[model samples]
Target: MTDNEALASASNSAIAAAVARLAEASASGVPRPPVRDLIGRDDLAAAYAVQAALTERRLAAGARTTGRKIGLTSEAVQRQLGVDQPDFGVLFDDMAHTDGATVPAGSVLQPRVEAEVAFVLRAGLADGPLDTEQVRDAVGYGVAALEICGSRIADWDISLADTVADNASAGAYVLGTDRRTLAETEPADVVMSMSVNGTEVSTGTGAACLGDPLAAVAWLARTARAFGEPLRAGDVVLSGALGPMHPVSPGDTVTATLSGFGSVTVRFGTGEAA
Candidate 1:
């Protein structure tokens, strides 16, 4: 192999090994050292390569791809993560849950929840710049979704590369039953409120997510295509969070209610932390 190819292969192997270590940490419910710390560099390209390798490993192990998730869309989240733009991650079939489901707290490390809107696509979208209307038209319906985010990095100390390498810190997601077409409602105006045990914790609007949730979906379509993976039909894309993420623990019952769309609830089981 050429020198450039040899260097690329070495980097890929290093990233793959880091991904495997993180997977072990996830399985054992323990947070591992950040990949940046282990590799001594913060390269976004290398981080994405690690994410792709881990995703391929999951797929090879029989986990089916369900869709994609957009993260760091809200200004608040961006500020929190110290990033200027958003990131994308792949979602698998097993990561999806219906409304009112109980999530095993042990399955995730440093679990948190965010309220979001989910787009169920009816047609495949190709790579290219797309308008909001185009993105809206491709969606079969939109539903209330609660994204369960977890970080395998110790104490959630993560940079952009760290989180990206960890699949955008994606854990699991739950979607509400209420579905509506874009024509039925104004997605930009939809408001969402999240509560834990009957007490409100966070509130935000659809505009908080990249100005409009549909715009975030459009961005995902374009970005995924640029990465050589276009969004497919039947995919459920989780538009980024409308508000700040709320921490959850065992016995916590979190509910997110969206205007026009129904509410979704997830109860955490009594699994001890690692």
Candidate 2:
């Protein structure tokens, strides 16, 4: 087979195996093996295929499709990875959490914390050229969210493509109680700051997310369409993080403060005893 054909075959095999793994994880309550190991090709195409298959299974099981998430939206992250833009992932009902709730650290592998903005989609958006105002109109409200990320990989060292296939290392999110109308909040005009252990660890501005976080959401909606799954209504799309990712350990409290949307805080469980 030619290279393209070989890749296609490999992707097909990976997708099937991924679906099986998903079933196994769900049944046994164990984390699935890192996609990098399960699939020989740790690329975005393979990852998206796995995501699509998993999404199909979730929909079949009566799970509600809420929205999408944009990862690596920070310019610092992009520069670190040598990429100019962000990646996307799907979000289901089970992946959400309410603010002021404590998240058990045991639920994820290699968990970390990130501060972000979330857009609740009021209208359907698909592939097309989208401007900032158009994106703002599509969003009904915005919330302060703390993204908890976990890696299936036993070890954290991985490439961008590998990370993408690992579902953008998404674990869960805590949505703040405070919600603001999009018309009132211009994503670019706000600043983001994160503190860990009562000390400021990182800081960034909303403009870090492609000039405007709403624009990031717009890019995600279009990108989802290009990937064959268009964004839909009632989706709470995470517009990406405004600051650097802070690694979390047991007994650590992570807090992200947005200029106007309020803040989200999560306390992690203690780490394994040495």
Candidate of highest lDDT: 1
What's the C-alpha lDDT at position 17 in model 1?
A: 76
Q: Write the per-residue lDDT of candidate 1 for residues 1-274, one digit (tens) a residue.
A: 2222233333656776777888888678789888886443456676777788778789999999999999999998787777788889999998988899989857768988999999999988884456677787789999999999989988888888789889999999999999988888777898999999999998999999999999999998888886778899999999999999988989999999999888999999886665
User: What would you estimate as the lDDT of candidate 2?
Assistant: 0.74
Predictions in order: lDDT:
0.86, 0.74
Q: Please give the TM-score that candidate 2 achieves against the real structure.
A: 0.84
Q: Quote each prediction's TM-score.
A: 0.92, 0.84
Off by over 4 Å in 1: 1-10, 38-42, 272-274
lDDT of 2 at 150: 71
**Candidate 1: worst-modelled 10 consecutive residues by lDDT:** 1-10
Superposing all C-alpha atoms, what RMSD in Å does each candidate have to the true structure? 3.1, 4.1
